[model samples]
Target: MTEIQAGLTVCTVLVVPYIVQAIKTKAMTGNVARWIAISVSTLCGVLTAMAGGMPTDASAWVTSIFAAVGGVQVAYAAFRSVGVTDKWLDALLALGDIKED
Candidate 1:
């Protein structure tokens, strides 16, 4: 494998679990710490994906796919922590028909 591929693979191996742990412990660990971890992991994932290049190979794509998923999971967890429910998310989706009555 290429140097870039090897570097990204190592980064993914290290960052993926950190991101998952941050999301899992966000409730007990405080949002600040969790957000810091999430931010770092997000940056690492982006870098890994960029280094991995196009989707021509499995290793090239897994980091990006997993990073995107991790980011979304953290966002959802953040919203849920603040008491934002699925109904609120659906309401946001229906902004054009918002009712004030």
Candidate 2:
């Protein structure tokens, strides 16, 4: 993933969950919406991590992940600035289901 990809991921994370919540509100309970937000957050983190590059392509995969980590850090910082870190965003990583391979 490049910076563009990271930016797109940020936008998707910012928008998709709310859209999902809104469209499915009648059938979607609080717990379901919470899980949807968690899932999108986890996927965005993974997308950003790919900015570090894939393992097969780089021997310095750890370093790449490190480099790309800052992008996610900054994104979370913005989220924090906007007070998006209450229950859902705060638990985003703790509930992340993505696994590095």
lDDT of 1 at 57: 66
- Per-residue lDDT tens digits for candidate 1, residues 1-101, read 45775566455544454444434432655566555555666566656666645457666556564654475455556655664533454455468785788
Of the candidates shown, which would achieve the greatest TM-score relative to the real structure? 2
- TM-scores, all models, native as reference: 0.34, 0.41
Report, for every candidate in turn, its global Cα lDDT versus the true structure. 0.55, 0.53
Q: After superposition, how far is residue 62 of candidate 2 from its true place, in Å?
A: 12
Model 2, residue 87: what's the lDDT? 45
CA displacement after TM-score superposition, residue 28 of candidate 2 (Å): 1.7
Model 1: clashing residue pairs? none
**Which regions of candidate 2 fall more than 4 Å away from where they truly are?**
55-101
Give candidate 2's total backbone clashes: 0
